[model samples]
Target chain A: MIFLSTLPGVRAVKNLRVLFMGEMQRLQRYHIIAASLVVAVIWIGVLHFTDVDDVTSIFPLLLFLDATSMSITLIGVSMFFEREEHTLKALFVSPITKGEYMISKIIGNIVSNLQTLVILYLYAWFFKEINLNIFLLVFYVIVISVFHSMIGFLLAYRSKSFTELLTGVLKYMFIFLIPVVLEQVGVITGDLLTNLMYALPTKAALLLLNSTTNGVETWEVLYGIAYLIGLSLLLSVVIRKGFEEFVAKESGI
Target chain B: MFKVENLHFTYPKNKEETIKGIDFEIREGEVFGLLGPSGVGKSTTQKILIKILQDFEGSITYKGKNLKDYGRDFYEEIGVGFEIPVHFSKLTAMENLQFFMKLYKNHEEPDELLKKLGLYEDRNKKVGEFSKGMKVRMNFVKALLNKPKMLFLDEPTAGLDPKNARIIKNLIREYRDQGGTVILTTHLMNDVEELCDRVAFMADGKIVEINSPKNLKLQHGDRKVEVEYEMGEKLESQMFSLDDLKEDEEFFRVVKNHRIITMHSKETTLDDIFIDITGGESSEES
Candidate 1:
């Protein structure tokens, strides 16, 4: 506790709990959490009809999509609501720091991602055959969601409208997430191309998620954990800078 | 509580400064009005004082400490009511107030404030369902929720019936009597005339005039009393210098020999003074 308090901004994190609770409440009020549940049911439907009774191979793929894409989309949608309602402008004048605001949103996004994970995992366990380490999956989902939430912040800061934010996410999906997903599904083939997949963060995410079943090597797990954690730290700094710029613009500086 | 000196700020995308070098002081416990037309930099200056915009070129000392020396804690001591709506549309009025109320160490009771503002019955209604006047009143309630030492109010009564506007004005007076400092920005000269203790008018990013509203009127008003009298089925009027009217025989003759239709001193309104000093068209809210 003392070490945590000694961190630069941690001691000044006032109203973080209230802000996080408010975020969660608004997510429910705006039907965002309901939408996540609907998406989770869709994932459950996909798993139910698959031919393979042992669902270990496909479980990680479902989580990878949820933890990465849903995380970004949820943050984007919530922020756009704030922008539309001008609630962000009100929050700007409160006692909460920018760090606290961003952390609350990230934590709120993690809750939604975790909900999807729990729903899908419960369905697979009760209705089908599955084997994986649940604790490790939870950890990987958190890390991946945090990284993508930062991406969401960047996209939201630059987007002028909700449609523009969706377009930016689509561009990101095409460039970074699609190729890695294609390689994972056996659509693209080659030793050189397969090795180059390591450059994409989504590949690292999939590797971490896939490691729960014990096929992935120890070094690959370490690399995935390190890569995602390190990239999240780097993006945090960029996201903070972007937040300052956004505040300036919104304040009519 | 704030003393700003030679303050200058430019937007990142603009080549010229929006708040050109200007100086002003907001004394504690007094309502200081920062009045101007559109594009005159008053809003930019208010944003700077609230710590929303940094990188300003000069110095601002709040309570004798540099404004930059303050951080997130600065917001704990100040509250701002923006001109536009700033609440979550989907949240109930009470919910919106409660969410912001908990963020401050010192907070007022939401129910009491809502009742005072005549919004108690609608506390459970969503803010998106509120009328414009209700939303404006809600903004006021939110600004006072923190019990802030200093308040920044932008058009506190912009959209309201006369009765509601008076209620807001009376509440402002009561808040001032309790020793709260306020920085008000509004184009409505009537509000300024009633509420402001001192006013500064900005023109082209510079403070062109600064004084009490009465003083500004005195400085810009005509120094003659216009008197109209009924004479032979017509009304005849004449202007007498206020300085000599008490002793002038002509003024006495006019008052005694004729039935005076109307007679009064010609004191200028703040609206006329605003236009005269700022050299801008009146953007006063109707």
Candidate 2:
């Protein structure tokens, strides 16, 4: 039933599995787990401060958890390892097309993000957000994780070096994470929030979470999901083309 | 199996062409060396041959068809072990092999390959902890996993220890013995000397010389042979031209009256011949 590769059985599937396995093990480190756990704790603390006491609100943080740190971290880490191992040369030599390789990477990231999503869902259970709507929640998690992974892929492709990719993501955070956090906090405090948050991906995922858990029928949730799928697809095309160009020009043997 | 004709390639921003009009052919079963010092277009040529560098001005015909027509499938028939190793550092050695093995239409057992390179014991360890030589061995294993018809090796032994390097060289030989073609690029004269059935020396993007390593050495070599022997309780030496020495009275006297110890042809090395033909002092790189 598994015919993932043109080659036959699970060759492509195996490669995908390996890519995911490697990335997951990297995130299994104490420091990485501690950092993510701390993020979860801070989200809980924020819920207490706001007194909204809605556990569903924290759903957006998973998107933030993956997009800001996990995907960005994985891509940066992969690039650094490629440089150190000099493995891109091997990839260049293989029969696998650049397009195929990039797809494998995206699929790998999505699979690995499953673990992160499960952890987030576990945290949501503590707040009475886990319910019969689990299937819808799963769909949301998959879509959002994929969307952020595409963003990270684009980010990594644009940066010339690993350090450069990291700094670029940090700069992107300046433009992205801060505004969404402020807008969410404003909404919690019943203050006027900037509509600029509408453009942020974090806001889209958060809106989806708010609607799914709280059963809100606001247009914001639909708009956010649509925005995420559209943006993720657009970014996938852009980054794939960008990566093709990068391989063509980068002269390292 | 492949023929590259009048190939010309230049990077977009560079004024100078990196590969200037070179022609070469690799028959079905032979080890062909692209010998040159660093930046002499060896890697550039490999990149072009492997279809990594396009916008080339000439034609590359594989089995009488345009390489462009084949697309990524062309890689299925060719196994390339780069001069550098490529793997996910966080993954184990077996994991790297297992991933690459799936990319090919055909396959072999990674366990057997790992054992061949003495990497089986460490197959489960993350590649991050592997030494440089171990990574090189794994790279070789990756290349062989598909059982390719043509192999491209760019200084495949640069970082390996002597024993491992010898094993790789032998594998290249065995691959050729099984009717595989090889393209090896390196400045290591010994590698070219030992493995190459034919070699082309490049400098600044043009092949200045091409021939069998033995022929190149012989053509440019000193025509004299150095003979060492003991005569009258003293070590003696004599130089003789290989052209005609069968009837030389002095040579006969030395061989007849003295005990011959060691005699070697005064042949120039492949590197010396490369320097002579390419007319450039080899720089430290490759």
Give the alpha-carbon lDDT of every model: 0.89, 0.73
Q: After aligning candidate 1 to the native by TM-score, how far in Å is the CA of A84 from where it should be? A: 1.3
The per-prediction i-RMS, to one decimal, reads 1.8, 3.4
Task: Considering the two chains of model 2, state its CAPRI-style docking category.
Answer: acceptable
lDDT of 1 by residue, A1-253 (tens): 7576445466456467889999999999999999999999999999999999888899999999889889889999999998887788788898878888899999999999999999999999999999999999999999999999999999988899999999999988898888988998999899999899898899999999999986899999999999999999999988888789798667521
The DockQ score of candidate 2 comes to: 0.46
Candidate 2 C-alpha error for residue B244, in Å: 2.4
TM-score of 1: 0.95
In Å, residue B118's CA in model 2 sits off its true spot by 3.0
